[model samples]
Target: MRAFVSMLSGILFGFGLALSGMMDPSRVRGFLDIFGDWDPTMAFVMGGAVIVMAIAWRMQKAMNKPVVCDQFSLPGTKLIDARLIGGAALFGIGWGLAGLCPGPAVASLANNLSGAAIFVAAMIAGMVIFRLTERPAQ
Candidate 1:
């Protein structure tokens, strides 16, 4: 049941990404090119998602346990540390360059976009490198 729900949710998310034209790297790049020719479509998509998730977070505060899990698994830290900032900067650089973060990159694979495979491969390699080189949390 859990696996089914997870798979179904992923499918729905990918479908939504496809429907919103998020599978196009050029469209994402246009959004980042704010001074040149900004595409505000993704801003609307992200705004809609933020609104929905805001409501979900409010509802989560009222619940003691999740419907599909034994307990809520929310983030514990709210710290704005150097590590967090550095990670965000790195992510922004990569996003600005490739214009396809993990979610859309994976979703673009379905359409067989020209650079999607290379991007996904690099992303996986980065993850593996991080896992291998990461120091234990103190």
Candidate 2:
């Protein structure tokens, strides 16, 4: 049941990404092109996501447990540390260069995008390296 829900959620999320043109690298790049031909589509998409998540947060606080899980597996810490900052910076840099973040990049794989395979491979390698070198949380 949990697996089915997970698969359904993934399918819905992928469909949304594709429908929103997020699977297109050029569209994402345009959104990041602040100094040039900027695209506002992503802004709307992001804004909608923020709105939905804001509501979700409110509802989550009211709920005792999640529908599909025993408990909500949200982030444990609110700490702002060097590792967090560095990871965010790295993610931003990759997003700017590749025009696709993790979610969209994974969805782009199904489309057989030209550079997506390489990007995903490199992303996976980076994750593996990070896991290998990660320090124990303090």
Candidate 3:
């Protein structure tokens, strides 16, 4: 049941991304090009997502526990440390350059873009490198 729900949720999220024009790297790049022909469509997409998330969060809070899980799987850490900032900066830079974040990069695989394939391969390589280099948190 949990796996089914997880897969369904992923499909829904991907569908939303596609519907919002987020699956296209060119669309995202246009949004980032503020000095050029800047596009504000992504902003509207983000705003709509934020609104939906806010409402969902409130409703989830009203519940004692999740329907699928016995307990919530929320992250415990709240502090914004240097590590977090550095990682986020790296992510933003990569997004700006590639015009595709992890979600969209994976979603765009169906489009058979060669760049997307390279990006996904590099992303997987980076993940493996990070796992091998970093020690597990105590």
Candidate 4:
């Protein structure tokens, strides 16, 4: 049952990405472009997502635990650290250059985009490196 729900959630998320024009690198690039033919549609999409997430987060706080899970899966720490800053900077640079973030990059794999394939490959490599190097949190 949990597996089915997870699969359904992923399908819905992928559909939303496709419907929002996020699957197109050109649309994302246009959003990032401030000088030439800049587009703000993606900003609105992100803003909407943030708003929804904020509401969901608040609602989650009122509940003792998640209904669908055996344990609470929320992050335990809230701190501003070098690792967060560095990761954000790296992500921003890559997004500015390729105009494709993780979600859209994964979606692009189905479309047979070569750049997306490379991006996904590099992203997996980075995750593996981080896993191998980082100490497990206490």
Give per-model TM-scores: 0.93, 0.93, 0.92, 0.88
In candidate 1, residue 113 scores what lDDT? 65
Give per-residue CA lDDT, model 1, range 1-138, as digits (tens).
Answer: 878899999999999888887777788889889999999999998998999999999999999998788988877877898989998998898888998889989988878766899999999999999999999988
- Segments in model 4 whose C-alpha atoms lie over 4 Å from true places: 135-138
Order the candidate numbers by TM-score, best to worst. 2, 1, 3, 4
Best by TM-score: 2
**lDDT per prediction?**
0.89, 0.91, 0.90, 0.90
> Predicted candidate 2: what Cα RMSD to the true structure?
1.2
Q: After the best TM-score superposition of candidate 3, give how far the Cα of residue 67 lies from its true spot, in angstroms.
A: 1.5
lDDT of 3 at 21: 91
lDDT of 4 by residue, 1-138 (tens): 888889998999999999998888889999999899999999989998999999998999898887778868867786988878999999999888888889989988998579789999999999999999998777
How many backbone clashes does every candidate have? 0, 0, 0, 0
Write model 2 residue lDDT over 1-138, tens digit each, in one string.
Answer: 999999999999999999998888899999999999999999999998999999999999999999989988887767898888999999998998989899999999988666888899999999999899988977
Model 1 — which ten-residue stretch has the worst lDDT? 106-115
Backbone clash total, candidate 3: 0
Residues 29-101, model 3: lDDT tens digits:
9999999999999999999989999999898889989888998877676689887899999898888888899
Q: Judge candidate 4 against the unseen true structure and give its global Cα lDDT, from 0 to 1.
A: 0.90
Query: Would you give me the overall lDDT of model 3?
Result: 0.90
